[model samples]
Target: MASFNEDGLKKKLDDLNMSQQSIQTVSLWLIHHKKHAHAVVNVWYRELISATDSRKLTFMYLANDVIQNSKKKGPEYNREFGSKLGKVFDHLGGLRLDDKSIKGLNRLLTVWEERSVFDADQIRSFNKNFNKDHSKEKSKKRDHSKYESKSKRHKKDVEEFEEIASEPRVRRESELTEHSPQDSTPPSDPPEPEQLIEALQELESAATSDAVVREKIASLPDEVSDVTLLNNLQDLNAARALSQKVEEALAMLEVYNKRLAEEMEARKSVARMLHDYIAYQKDLLAQAEETLEEHRQKQGKVKKVREELKAHLQNLPDISKLPNIRTGGLAPLPSAGDLFT
Candidate 1:
């Protein structure tokens, strides 16, 4: 394995525009002793760390090198690198991405992968390790935007459901305000269990209608916040049970929303088809009108010729007064009286 001394590594990384701390953060992932004796400890370690995306690209390139060497020389190259990368990301402090630079990062990885420039096994191992650690941290993770839903353009059903849910909330707010003058009051009752069941049923129906059913189920924890109050109830076990049911319902709703999005897209396609057909028909109609006008002009010319021929026929001499002319016979010699006329 080709190795880099500290100065060589620094120069290479600097040329790639990596900041000092960014180098340090990624350095935590360096494990191939030939390259460097340094080893990584953790991913997020409890504080939000700032690193430009360029640094991450540099990290990925270094990673590709480390992993490739490990595949050919030793498996530890992939093993240690993935373990450290997973830890850092699993507990990621926070990341601010430059959307513009994201394109470059994506392109770099794509080109590298296409060239078979790195060990595919190393990439797979990293992903596997990351997901394993990610699953372990789910319960402790608070920022619940995994698989974030798309824009409202595709969220019709979800938006409608949210609207329905917010109505009773509004009424509760009014009641609270009306009774607020120097008086302590009991909190409003949680909605009836039947209402929850109905909502749950609606969500389940939606889920069944969706194409990506399993993904909807997986993202339920992140999508449902209204149900969390169930966990705070006095009867913890009952609350837990209700929460589970709500979670199931949320999964269904997510599925249904995705189905709705699909339906909307399908409708747009149909609309476009109809529009194109109408335009095509209009073009055909225009061509037909042009053809009709051309035919009319030709018919007019034919009528003029027929009229002239009729006039010529009306002006012809009376053949009954003249000698009969037979086919293939010479015409009668002109009389001397005709020649004089």
Candidate 2:
């Protein structure tokens, strides 16, 4: 942007009046930048607050253009126009929105902002700054967790941040639009059908000179006469309807693909658990089989001892046929009886 004295800046704004297309080009350029975009939006906000413009609607229109760019860009350009709508509300908050039209615009911005995907850090800060009403409720729910050691708490925080970073977040088609549409400038009625057809025909024949193309470009401010212009303004409302539809389909497909990945991961976990369980059962079975085999061997040894004792009893002589042998008397005929037997 050209650095301009106060007069120079006013002249530029004046020159932009007859050219809505120029306003859009300039507006999007400024909004895509951080410091410049905020500065531009703030300038408009100040103008609205101070009522500096003789024609306030003119400034309102420009401001609305800024917001509309952000909305159309959506989260796809989040870094460029981060929290710009919230900045507008910085001044426009509270009872000032009683006007029905302002209320409508405000409602539109609120919806757009809700659909937007903000940075996690910025969101945390916003809630921390503005969510005082919930503080009491949170305090009541607070547990002895605060008493935990500092090291453990730090570890927990690190884990949570890692988990969030690793988590698969699904951004919708709306996420592509960074700015909100504050004022929806109705498209000028297309040139009468006859004139449009003439323009189309003119477009078909190649211009022999850059002079003619430049003349056409410079004439009546500026226009996107071809693919370049259409692509440049694709972030705007009607231009994006088709692209946005395509984006919606892609987002849904992304969510489905992520869900399938998670399901597969869970399946792998269950399979591992089953494998571990089977190995544990096998160990127990082996221990039981070994114990049974030991018991069988011990029972076989005991049977062998019983059989040996029975054989020894059968080998002993009968008491009735044997010669008498008392504790104190001699067995005189033992030898003769043995010989007769």
Candidate 3:
């Protein structure tokens, strides 16, 4: 594990042109470490060339070493418990190690610690002891607080119900006092208890029907295990699965379309290359042909000149080199020779 200063790491990366994969890996680690991740990434972009092979590998190795070491350090080293750490790493490398491989790594580390290869066990044990003590204290406080809250809520509900129940009694008592019992009092129907119950039910139903309930239910904790909650969850899961399948199909279709587009682009590129190559070859051939014709015409002119000179020389009488000016002097120019010769 290295004590990496962001400045030092950037300097090292700049010295070597690292790839994007390497940069992203380092940036994510900087994030995992809870130190300015994006700032570090920007620094990397500003400093690193992003083209050097060794630079990428270096960042990747350093990041892996740091993360592994941090995890070994303690729970404080762990980020949000359910964070998608694997996805981050996978995206950086453009490769994925499956669940089994990851589990195997965990198992290997556990075995190594158990074998007393290092002081990992002591550190882990200390962390566990402290965490347990803290958790127990926290739970006790929370439980007592929750108990008080429930008691208060129960008292409030009872008071509200009692006030409601007393309203009808007070009305009846006033009516009886206002008129003598059975003294020519017209019979008036009082609201039935069932009607009140029905109205309450209707109010509750309306409240549940509001869109907010759907949102709240959707946000409920995944750990809920109550039977009704579980049933609703299962139904929701089925709907989600169907939606996911539809989304997957759409994604696959998009990929297919993109691939088709790329293939078409590739074909066009090949065609253009072929056209350029053929045009170049054709131009070369035409130039070569023109040159060959010029060379052939020159050769023919040379042959004609030689024939004329030979005729002129043969026409001259055989004379000793000194005597005949026609034969002894330098041969006449082609134009100076007689037409017949």
Candidate 4:
């Protein structure tokens, strides 16, 4: 495990790649140190601000992974990232992003919205900041269109052009053809070995690790639960004191219950992530093995062809040993009259 320090985290951010595995790996690390989530988010934002344009989206993906995955564990990461994401979006909106990058960010926003990762207002704010330039461009285009005037023929042509542009492209013959299951399915991108190890290790000490809370819940005083005992109370003051003790006990139980619920949810979330991760890795491994078999079959065919070609070559008379046709080494001439006789 890397040190839970700003410098170490910065180094990790510096090496981050725009792959799911990379994003998940870093996310797991952040979640593992979620006690320091506030500090982690601060470093993440600072690094994101300073990172290159190409690396910025990757940072956003990392943040999204952490926020979504760690939310069940606790609200620390969610709160920290929620506070900073608006500014991050503001920074991103200022850059000249490509269509792909824009779509990627939009997809993340959609996921966040669909998952209810943030409240409606926060998601709306993020969308506004992220799409500021796009919204402005659309507004400008609308304003421009209002002032434009054209001949009837030109207007018809423009309308036709717009219609054609809006229509979906026809698929090519090859693209329309049926594909095998393997071809239809996208390739899997499994996480690094180290990442899987770390994730498994983190799961070993999951939210259920708090035995103290469990102990406290188990050791509640009997007076709090035994209402029959209240019948024996001799005075109103004693009964009131008993009531106070009962109230305190109830309060403690309520707090512990909430904690337990959170822990249970966190455990379930980790289990889900692990299951998906493991399934993906297994699928990838199977695919790789299938590919390896295919390559081996191809190699065997190539080797057989080479051996056949070698045998055929060896069976042929050597050119050097054969008589040179140009030297006329054999007697071949016969006259027509000699043949008749």
**Best-performing candidate as measured by TM-score:** 4
lDDT of 1: 0.44
The C-alpha RMSD in Å for every predicted model, in order, reads: 29.5, 34.0, 36.0, 16.8
How does model 2 fare in lDDT? Answer: 0.43
Model 3 poorest ten-residue lDDT run: 162-171
lDDT of 1 at 203: 50
lDDT of 1 by residue, 260-329 (tens): 7766554433333344334434534664576589889999999999999999999999877675566535
Higher-lDDT candidate of 2 and 3: 2
Cα error of candidate 2 at position 17, Å: 8.1
Question: Candidates' lDDT values, in order?
Answer: 0.44, 0.43, 0.42, 0.69
Identify the runs in model 3 with alpha carbons over 4 angstroms from their true place: 1-253, 312-341
- Could you arrange the candidates by TM-score from highest to lowest? 4, 1, 2, 3
| Residue-level lDDT tens digits of model 4 in 1-341 | 33467866786788788655566556766776788998998888998898888677678777777776666568998999999999999889888765445656787787778768899999999998989887765456557754245233345533432322222122243532343223433222233457667766765555456677667767877777987777788999988998898887789778767766876665544444455456555644664576589889999999999999999999998988877778997678899988999
| Candidate number with greatest lDDT | 4
User: What's the TM for model 3?
Assistant: 0.20
List runs of model 4 lying over 4 Å from the truth. 136-341
Q: Clashing pairs in model 3?
A: 17-52
Predicted candidate 2 versus true structure: per-residue lDDT over 1-341, tens digit per residue: 22323343343355454244445443444443434554554454555555532333334345545544454434233443444535443434422222222323333333334544454565444344433343453354355465246435445433432322222122233532332222233221112335444544543442322355445334522232244545555456756664565465556546555655655444433333334334434433564576579779998999999899999988988877765566445545568768998
